[model samples]
Structures are given as C-alpha cells and as structure tokens.
Target: MNTFITLAIVLIALSFVYTWGAAASRRVASQTGEKLHSRPPYYGLYLVLWCAIPAAIIFIVYSLITPTIETVIIQSYFPQEVLNDAAELANQTRQVESIAGGFGMFGEPAPYQVQAAAALKNVEWIGKMALVALIAVAAVAGTLVARTRISPEFRARNRIETAIEMLLITCSAIAVLTTVGIVLSVLGEAVRFFTFVNPIDFFLGTSWNPRFSTTGHGGQGDFGLLPLLWGTLMITIIAMIVAVPIGLMAAVYLSEYAGPKFRFVAKPMLEVLAGIPTIVYGIFAAFTVGPFLSTMGDAVGLDINATSAFTAGIVMGIMIIPFVSSLSDDIISQVPQSLRDGSYGLGATRSETIRRVILPAALPGIVGAFLLAVSRAIGETMIVVLAAGNSPVLTANPFEAVSTVTVTIVNQLTGDTDFASPQSLVAFALGLTLFVITLCLNVVAIYIVRKYREQYE
Candidate 1:
C-alpha cells in the first residue's frame, strides 16, 4: 500500500515536471526569436528533481520515524495504572493496539474499538494527501519560476548541467547515508545487548550461551566472543585456501591467455557458478560435497564429519570464485598493453610476462579482490548453516565441526524468539561486529583500488 502510494505520488510529480517544463519552453519561445537552450526533456528533468527530491527525502524520513513515533504515542495512550508497571506497560500497549486494530484501525472490524483507530486513520490519510499535494505544488511553482527566468540571455544549459551534477552527488550521498544508518541501528541494538551482558565477558569469554531469564535463578547467560571468532577465522581461511588460487588462475587465463571465443564461452560459464544461489550451494555442500569428503577421508584413514568446517568452507569458496575472478580480470585488463609488450620485447615468455609484470601491476587490485572475497566468505550464512556444524567450539582442525558468527545469529534469531531476551540481543551484537569487519574490508578495498589507479594512471 505504501509502495503504491509512493509510486502514485512520483507519477503525479512527474506530470507537474512536464507541465512546468512545457510552460517554461513556451514562455522562452515567446520571449526570444532563438531556440530554447536544450531539449524539453532536460528542462522537465530539472523541474522534476527540484519538486521530487526534497519530497522523496521527507517521505523516507517520515516512514522511518513514524513507527517510533507511533510506539511512543500508543504508550502515552495507556492509563497510569498500566504505565507504572514496567511489565504491564508493554502488554497493555499491545492490548490497546489490538483493540484499535479490531475496530478497523488498520484492517477489518471486530469488537472493542476506540478513538485511537480514527487517529491512526487520520494520520495515514494526512501523510499521503500532504505528500502528494506538496509535490504537485512544488512542481508547478518550480516550472513557473524556471520559465520566468528563461530568456535569450539565460544560461539554461549550464544551469541544467549543474543541477544534474548535484542530483548525482545527492544519490551518492544517499548510498553513504544508508550504510551509516544500518551501522547505527546495529550499534543501538548492540548497546542494548551490552546492558545485560558485560562487554568484557561478551568479548573475551570462551562460552557463548545466551539464555537470560526473568526467573532470578542459578543459571545466567554467557555471551562470549572468542570461540565464535576462532570458528569464523578458521572457516574463512579454509575458504580462501580453496578460492584464491583457482579464481586467480581462471582470471589470468580468461583475461590474458584465452582467445576471444574461449574467453566468451568460459567467462560466462564460470560466472554461472555465481548465479547459483547460496541456498542451492548449501544443499549441495551438505548432501553432495560432505559425503564425497567423508568417503575420501575414510579411504585416507582420516576422521571427518559429514557436516565439517572443511566442507562448508570449500563450498563457500566455490561461491566466492566469481567475485575474485571478475575483480581480478577487470584489474588485469586495466594494466596498460604497453607494459606487456615491453615485457615481450625483453624476451620474456607469456607466462613470465604475466607472472613478473602483469601480476605486479595489478597487485593492489588483486589484494582488494582477495579482501572482498574474504569478507564475503566470512559473512556467508546458508552454506555454513547446512554443512558446518553449529558447535561454537575453538578448534584448529578443518575436518572438525564449527560455527561462524552468521550461523550463530541465524540460530539465535530463528522461529519464535523473544526480541527483548539476551539470545535475540546477541544477534544484534554479532551483526554490529560483522558490519564493522565488512566496513574495514571495504575501506581497505577502496584504498587499494585508489593506490592501484594512481600507480597505473
């Protein structure tokens, strides 16, 4: 419903943009003998952006904050008798919402409804109507204003170009803001988790049993970080061991050695590996690769479980191959042709040229690719959930069962889990840690890519 309303608003705003641009063009044509500076479409885009961008931002902000505001308002609706009791406060607010909802506040009618239902309906209606009206008005005003400014002497082309540049920068800023928002949300939940579990105990302790209870009993929770870290590192290292060499060789062959036809066929075929979903990879790892490894281990007189870290890591590595290969290929291709020619002119073989020259030139990019691949392998959930045993144990053996942070999070948050409980809160803490690690890796990737660009350019 919200999506449909947003789309409708955008369409209406677009109509206004067109109207504004046409009016401006007509005015300009009347004012001057010369043709308009640019096409009508560009003028329309300028007006549309002016009307739509600020409105879009407001809509997004309102959508995010509305839930929190509603929660506070509903809490305020509860009588003081309910409010004084911390335990009752949550339940009573829920009951109030249930009563309001039953009265057709959000859906169909039921029994006991109140003024809250009407209030909610009013709020929803006001939000949609206001947004649409504001966008339309802004669009009309922008069109008229731009048209008034348009004349033979006016630099419409320059103005339009500058506006587009600002829009692009705004888009980039939105992406960055979105990332920051995610991190902030994770941090907020993690802070809540830390309130129950001591930060030191959460970080350093070996045991990770998050079972907080209201029953003031002998058993408290143990939110440790070490065992999960060990498991994550081991699995990630095993995955990198499998992925790095194969992905690099595939990239090298495709980018430099293969003929055009071979490259065309092989590149997409190799990328087909990436197109296969992670869940499919998980099932394959659990049912197929696990058994195959067990059989091989049995013949070799090594004890290995069906659901082992090695199995999960190997499957994850296969999933990450395209990431490494694709990035490496781009970097390798970016290496100047003159360098390879110089190497060949110095009597270097193709293999020697690639080994000594091309690889060196693309080292930063290759490192960046490897870092990205590692981050991916670290964050992979399904493969580990299926094949890597969910035993958060600190072990060095690849053939042994282990679990990663993502698997632990999935386990804790699955099915009907209490959100306020320590178990669910732990998931947020793990998520924050995961986000931090990935952010660091991304920073490194950007730095490496920039350094590589500087070196080559």
Candidate 2:
C-alpha cells in the first residue's frame, strides 16, 4: 500500500518537473524572439508540474490524516455506555473489531458465521475498489486541468515559478509539521506518565528507577532525571573528546594539506565511515573495544565492565568522524582564497595562515559541523544499545556500565506491559526530553552560524 502511494507521488512529482521545464523553455524562447530549441514535451512537463505538485501535496496530507479520521469515526459508533466502563469497553472493542474483521459488513455481522464472513469480504472489496476508482478519477482530472493551462499565451514561465514556489512552501511546511507531530505524540504519552509518577520525583530525584506495583502498597519507583542526564552527558562528552580532535585534524589535512591525487582517494574513504551501519559499529564496540578496554583495565588493576559507556562512546565517535570532517572540510575550503594569500604575503608560515586566517574565517561553519556531529552522537542508539550498561547509576567514571534514555525506551516498550502503564508511558517522557534538548542545541548551532556569518560579512 505504501509502495503504491509512493509511486503515485513520484510520478506526480516527475510530471510536474517535466511540465515546468517545458513551459519555461518555451517562455524563454518567446521572450528572446528565438524559436524554441526544445520540443512540446518540455511545455507538457511545465504543465504537468502545475497540475501534479499541488494535487500530490493534497494527497499526502489526506493520506496522513485519513487513518486517524477513520479510526475516530469507527470508534465513535460505540455507545458511551460501553466506553465509560473501562474493563467492559476494552473487551467489547476488541470483540467488535474481531467480529468486524471476520463476519461484519461495516459494523453489523450476519446471524450465521458463514454469511457474516462472506459479507465482510464483500464490504472490504467494495471499499478498496471505490477508493482506487476515486484516486484514478482525481489523477485524471488533475492531469487534464494542468494540460489545459499550457496554451501559447498561458505565461508558462510565471505558472512554473508559481508551482515551484508552492512546492518550496509545502516542503518547508512538512518539516514544521513533522516536528510538531513528534512533539505532540510524545507530550500526550508524557502526560500519562506524569499521572502515575509524581512530576517532582521525575524531575528532581537522584535515582532513576520507575517500577510501579498494582497492589498500591509496594515502594513507588524513583523517577530522578539527574542520573539519566548524567549518563547521557558523560557518554556525549567522551564521544566529543574522541571525535573532535581526530575529525578536525582530518579536515585540516584534507582541505589544506592533501595533494590532488591523495584527496581524490581519501575524501571518499572518509565518507565510507558514514556508510557503515550503526549496528556494525555497535558490534565493534561490544566485542572489539569492550574486550580491549577490559584487558587494559586488568593490566592496570582497575575494574571495567564488558559493557561500559566509554567503549560505546568512543566507538560512536569513530562513527561520526565523517560527519565532522566532511562538513568542516567543505567550510574550510570556502574560506576566501584572498584571506590565505594576504596571510602568506605577510610572510606567515602555511600553518600560521591556516590556523590564524583560514580557520577563523571558516569558524562558523566549523562550529555548525561540530554541533551537528554532537547531535548525531547524542541521539545515537545501536552502539550504546550493544555496549553501554543497562544500569542507570549516576557515575562520572567512564568505565562503569551506564544506561541512556534511548536504551531504557527500547527496554520498556518491548516488554509485555500494557501501553497505558506508567512503565511504558515513561518512554514518551524521555523521548520528549530528548527532543527538546536536541531542538535547543540545533537552535544554538544555527545562532552561532548566523553570528559568524555577520562577523565575516
């Protein structure tokens, strides 16, 4: 189903792009008083863009919203009497859904099981076929309307520009919508968590445990924010410690020092690091780095867990080196050649010029690169999942096993507990916290880049 929808969207986008290019070419030729070098197909492409881009956007919005709307409608048909009875409602809804799946036409099942099953199949077939027919009709209408606007006097250039503008607007809106949706979803879950666990305990407690008992007399779990925060910061700091120097030096070499032949080979090699699966990195951290650290710890007479934050963090840093170097190298290379020339003319050494002039000019972009790498490091999961300890102890020691919020989220949701349980809902609270922190970091990075731009400009 998703594949089909995606193919339709792709086809729509291609048609729009084609229509815009064709129309644009024709308009350009007319304005310049020259015969069009390109044929009518280009104009057709321009028209397709005008038709498909808006329609495709509408379709995407509909697709996302349609499921929720349908679910609400289906759920609404149940009586308030049933919905109000918590235990009864759960059972009734489950049974109704099962009956609907196996024996109903819409919400009504036949008296006999065989007749009911046949009715259910008939309902499904009719519904799906109707939907497909509607989509086909919509597509045909959209294409025809777009093609109609493609006559010689249609101002194809302006129409294409309008379509492009709409597309850009839609793309920007999608980014905002995605963020909003994630936050809202997480916020709803967090609210449920706050009901079972005290807000103060979750925020202020030192210990980070969250076990709740149904008997109402068992010790309520500690819900401290500090320990998890500490573990996350520690691992992030370790990762930065490893990644920053190596990535920066690699960037320096690639942008300022490497020969053309060496660069051609080396740049792609660095990018290869980015291509490696995080799971592979996780296994490396667990099996390779963990054992190496244990051996070193044993020789030094220091205890180290087989799965520690240090091993996970260092391995994660290695995973993010390409992000830092590639971005930094690009920014460094963009430092105006004149700045380097001026430094060299003053009899400064190559290193002096790079360190004083080029680096300073490129500082904003470099900072942005680092921040992006840091964000990647902080949100990283698999390496930590494989190597970082599951205990949420608040410890500064890198060799000790520690858990992150992401690890806890995975552990909680994968268990047998009901989704409404505080144990399960706490995942959302943690997710919300992570989202806010990352969002703030990104804002700061953007500000730094902007300020740097102003300084240089």
Candidate 3:
C-alpha cells in the first residue's frame, strides 16, 4: 500500500481503538462502581500510546532493513566481476533500482539486469507487506497487553504522564545527540581536509582559489581563508550598519512611542519582510536592489557592480530586520515599569528617561539581539550566493564583488568532486569555522543576556 494510505489506515484504526478503549473504560468504571485512577479519556490515551509506540518502532526497524535486503538480493543476481568493482556495483545497483521503480532506464535493460530488477521489486514488495504485517501484530499485541490492565484500579493517568515524560526526554536526547553528531562529522571531515591542506595555510592564508591540489608545497592550492573571511565580515558589518539602527528604532517606536493601533498593524508588516524566503530576497537583491544601487551609483559618478558586498549586505540586513526589531521590542518591553515611573518622578523627559534609565536597563538584551542579528547575517547563504558576486578576493571596498564562507562552502560541495579531496573537504572546514564563530558569539550573547536577566528579574 502507499505510505499515505497506510498512515491514513493507521490513523483511522487508532481513532477507533481510542473510542473502544474509552467506552470500555467507562463501562468498567461504571459497572464496578469504583472510582477510577483517571478519567476514561486518560485510559484511552494510555491504550493509544501503547498501540502506536510498538507499531512505530516495528515500522521504523523494517524500513531501515529493507534497503540492505534489496542490495543483497540484487547482488546475488549480478556477476562477480560487476560486484568486485565498487563503482560498477553501485552503478548497476542504481540501474536495477531505477528499472524496478519503472523509470531511469533509457532503453531496454540487459537480461540479468531485468531479472535483478524484477527480484528487487519482489523483495521491496515483500518488505513493505512484512512491515505492514509486523506493525499490525505489534499494535494488536500492545493493545491486548494494555487492555488487560485497563480497570478502575489501573493508574492510566500516571502511566500516560510517565510515558509523555519519557517521550520528552527522548526528544531532548535526540536533539543533543544530533548536534554532537554534526560536530563530530564536520570535525572528522575537516581533519581529512587538513591532511591535504596545511591547517595554518587553510586558516591564515590570503588566497582562496580552490581546485585539485597535489600533495606538495602547501597542498598546491590557494585554499586561503582570509579572503572569504573578509567578505563575510565586510558584508556582515554592512548588514549590521543597515539593520541595527533601523530595526532598533522600529522596536523603540513600537514599544515606547507608537500608538497601539499603529504598532499592531505596523510591527507585523515589518516582520513580514523577515518571513519572505531568503532566496526570494536574494533574487530581489540581484534583479531589483542591485540594479537600483548600480544605477544610483552611476548617476552619482561611482562605478558600483550590480552584485557586490554592498548589495548583498543591504538585502541581508533587510532580511534580518525582524530578528532585531522583534527581539529588541521584547527586551525593551520587559524592563520594569517602575524604572520608567521613577525616571518620570525625577522630572525626566521621555527621551531622557529612555536614554538614561530604560536603555541602560535593557542594554545587555539589546546587545544580545544585535549579536543574534549578526549571527544570522554571518550564516545567511542565498543572499550572498545570488547577490554577492562570487569573487574570492580580499578587498576593503564595499562596491567590490566578494564571496563569503557560506557561498564558498556551497561552491566547493557542488558537483561530482571527490569527497576525500581537499577541494570538497574544504567545505567542511569552512562549515566548522562558521559553526565555531556562531557558537562563540551565541555563548557570549547568552551569557550577557542571562546576566542582564539576573539583575532585572
């Protein structure tokens, strides 16, 4: 059956099971005239959890193993020579899978390949059927086990709560482990890259033209970091220049000055800019803002490229405006009213009160918000990719076309390059560097924000 169809069936079955469980629980409670540990709905929820969890686990396990089974069965039909060569084996296996799925075969498939494809289809169908059966079996077993215990004496509420707690803990552990896995994977790839390119050269060098590098002096490529690093910082600084004042002023106006009606309407309208996809922003920058700037620059007797650090930065700054405005508004609003009241009692004007009391109180959080915006700017990819003309040259001019770490990472990882080569692996190094930079910035921002909270709260 189709995945969606199966899911729908499962959902319908679960709903029926829930109704059955609740009705049965209500009958048990009423017939025996005993106070239930929980209401009928809680017992239903407990049964639903028991049925779903085991079924989900069985489905997941079956899905994971199906591919391996297909591979083995397909390999059994292929010649030893094809199986001996890893590339040939992979290619043939892909062809088999494609033909089995009724696509990707340009012409008639070979006899053995067709046979293998047929077998693969059989195996996949068997796997799917087995998975469906296993899920049903597991769900029924779990339901029966739970059903026997579902009496007025059973603490279904306590059991359901405990299950929910475990689920939450599992989710937390999965998130932590995922982060750890990413760090380890990037570090491992970076180590592989470092073996080919000198760590010092990769980190400190000024050039960044990456191609195939021989294992010779400095790994034979200008895999420098400075040029890309400079581009990233330049664009980020320009973004901050554009974003900070405007976003903060917007926040201040909304929180401290604007009428409630205007604030309600205007704030979301401003934030709508943030909700626009970065790719769309990039396209706008490239096609609209970039040309607009270039025309304006030419009118003013300046030579500005359509795609430059300035263009990308301007668009990125616009994109991150809500990050600053929304966050600053929250922080600013959180400042205790007593501080404003005290400032007013001391014969302070609104502006003076804001400058001396409210701002100082909320400074750390505002700083944190700025840093958050900075982090967002540094990590942004599409705006730089499409707007910032891909020139990996170190320069101080805002008008110059420049490439950033994120764009470089995308360029390096694209195409059929060998992952073991420094050319491809450099992407990981660039990614790791960004991760570290953002991580450090986040850590510092969090520390500052927390300290401010301690004083304020």
Candidate 4:
C-alpha cells in the first residue's frame, strides 16, 4: 500500500476508536452521576490528537532519514574504487536506485551495480514495512494512554488548542526559513562570482559582453552592470508613463463616476487583461507593435529599431494596467463615505471633491499600487526578451535595442556551461542585484505609504 493511503487508514481507524472512547466515558460519567469538565467532542479530539500526533512525528522522521540510511547501506556494498570520491559514489548510487525503480539505467550496469540494485529494492521494502509497523505500535500505545487519562477532570480543550497553536507557528516558521534559505544560497553564489569579477567593474562599468571560455581558457569579457540597469530603468520609465496615468484615471472613473451596473460589467472585463499570459504580450510586441513603431519612426525620419525598448515598454505597460487599476480602485473605494459627504456639504463639486478630498485620503494606497506596478515592470522578463532587441548598450534612447538584467541572467544560465565558470556564476550576481533593487524599492514605498497614512489617519 502507498504510504499516504496507509497513513489515511490509520488516522481514520484512530478517529473511530477515539469517538468510541469519548462515548464510553460520557456514559460512565452519566452512570456515576459525575459531570464532564469539557464537552464529549473535546474528549474525542484529545484521544485523536494523542493517537495521530506521535504517529505523524514518527512517519515524518522515518521518511526524512530513510534516504540517507539507504544511501549509506548501498555505498557499503560498493568496491573501494567506486567509493574513492563522494560525488562519483553519489552519482553511481542514483543510477543503481533509478534502475531498481525501473526508470532504466544510463548505461549497461556492471555485476556489482546489479547486485546493489537488488539490495536497494529489498532495503526499500523493508523500510516501508518497518515504518508501517512502528506507526501501528505508536497509534495503539497512544490510544491506550489517552483512554486511561480521559476522566471528567481532564482539560482536553486547552491541550488541543495548544497543539493547534504550535502547529500554526511551525507552518509560519517553515515559510520564513524557506525564504531565508533561498536568499542565503543566492548571496553565497554571488560572493563567489565577485571574487572573479571586481565588484566596482560589475557595478559601475558601462560595458557588458560575457564571452564563454574555450580551449581551456578563462572568461574574457566585460561584466559591467550599468548597461543592463540603464536598459531596465528606461523600459520601466516608459512602461510607467503608459500604465500609471491610464490605470489611475480608469480607476478613478470606475470607482467614483461609473454607475453600479456599468462597474459590475466593466471591472471583470478590464481585469481580464491581467489574466493574459505575458508571453502572448511578448508575441504581440514582437509581431505587431515593434514593426509599427519602426515604420512610424522611419516615416517621421527618426531611427527606430524593429525590436527596441519602446516596443517592450508599451506592451509591458499594457500588461501592468490591470494591476494598477484594480489596486487603486479598491483603495479609492475604501475611502470613508463621510469624507465625501463632508466635501459635498461644503458645496464642493464632484470633481473638486475627488481631486482634493478623496485623492489625498487615498494617496498612500495609490502610491503603493504604483510602486507595485513599477516592481512588476522591473521584474518582467518575457515581454522584454522578445521585443527588446537585447543589445547590451548604455544608451538612454527608448528607440534603440537594449537588454535587461533578467535577459542577461537568462542568457548566461540557459546553456550547458560550468557552474564554477564566471560566465554562469554571473547569473547569481545579477539575480542578487535585482533582488536588492526590488527590496529597496519596496522599503521606500512602505516608508512613504506609512508617512502619508499617519498624516491622514
């Protein structure tokens, strides 16, 4: 039986047993003319917790340790030659396990490998049987102990609530730990990259050309960051120019002016823009907007590449419109109606009231929405990748082709290059830099929003 199915069966059986225990205790209490401290359900829950929690802990610990133990047992069967290096041993062990699981071998298996595979299969079966047996024993012991302890005076509800609170804290801690782990991994790799390429050159140099090493040579190209940063900012500026005004105005109209019937129909339709895949936007930019801009620029006697920052910016802006509008609209709608009433009582017109009263009251949220849109624009990859011609240049022209940090990261990491090489390691540095930039932007946005919120509140 599958481990999950076995676990489910154990839990279900224990639930029934606990229910019976609760019912028997309640009947005993009634016959003895004694009152229970907590409800009958609390007693059932207490018994269920005792049965399930210990078994779950055992299952989790066994699952975590099983692979390491199996790997050690398999490695013990290998010859001294195969076990000379840890990396090679691990690779060979994976191959044995894959073949044992019927996933097919990478190449023809040796006699020793075939033996190891059989051993692995047998060990896995034994492990599963041992795990099931242990869980059964734990469940039976817990049920007995819980039944013995269940009396009219037991504080079952408090113990159950404490367990639940601890579970919630554990889940929250896992999320925080996972985020820290990712950031630390990226930061460590980036530090290794900086040892090869100077931090000053990476940050301040205007050039960016990462030539891969060939013929046992090292990397021989500029690893400047300014070009990518400039391109990113230029495209983001253009996108915000297109997105912010239109999105905010739309939000204002929808929230303050539109009738209920119109809002109900139109809001969903507008938000559908957010649902469209960004790759589709990239395709549209590459095919339609890019060519149109080039032709229009030629007609006007200006130089514009077919695939340029202008094309990507406009498309990305369209993609971000729903983000700004939806958030801003919600914020605008949340403004207290009493504020609007106060403005109206002062004989202020609708437009004046909206411009002066409603906008100021909702400014903090609107700023947060705009900053979020800007972050989204900065982090966008697909639209820029397809539409921007991807020239790593430090020019300020939107009509020129450019590349972003994300695009460069993709370029570096896509091919089969050595992770130890500067060519590939640069991707981690670029990712870290982008992360820091976004983090700073978020901090600034939060600070500004808080300042305004304090004033308004």
Q: Count the backbone clashes (under 3 Å) in each candidate.
A: 0, 10, 0, 0
Of candidate 2, the 10-residue stretch with the lowest lDDT total is 109-118
In candidate 2, which residue ranges exceed 4 Å CA deviation? 1-43, 46-152, 213-219
Residues 158-208, model 3: lDDT tens digits: 988999899899999999999999999999999998888888988889988
Q: Please say which candidate is ahead in lDDT: 2 or 3.
A: 3
> Which is the winner by lDDT between candidate 1 and candidate 3?
3
lDDT (10s digit) by residue, model 1, range 187-284: 99899988877888888888876675554322456778888888888889889999999999999999998999999898898889989989999999
Winner of 2 and 4 under lDDT:
4
Error of 4 at 331 (Å): 1.5
Tens digits of lDDT, candidate 4, 251-281 = 9999999999999999999999999999999
- Cα RMSD, each candidate: 4.9, 5.8, 2.5, 2.9
User: Local distance difference test, per candidate?
Assistant: 0.81, 0.78, 0.90, 0.90
Question: Which parts of model 4 are misplaced by more than 4 Å?
Answer: 2-41, 85-88, 212-219
> Pairing residues by index, what is the TM-score of model 2?
0.78
lDDT for each residue of candidate 2 in 1-457, tens digit (9 for 90 to 100): 6899979976775666575556665676677676653365656656565455555666677678665554444445556776688886566545544665654335543244334334444555665676566655665677667665554545555655677788799999999999899889999989988987887888777887677645431465667877887778788889999888999999999999999999999999999999999999999889999999999999999888879988888898898899899999999998889998889999999999988888889989899889988888878888888999777988888899998878878887985889987778888998888888888998998888887778778
Tell how far residue 109 is off in model 4, in angstroms: 2.7
Q: Estimate the lDDT of model 1.
A: 0.81
Q: Could you estimate the TM-score for every candidate? A: 0.79, 0.78, 0.91, 0.91
Alpha carbon lDDT at 177, candidate 1: 100
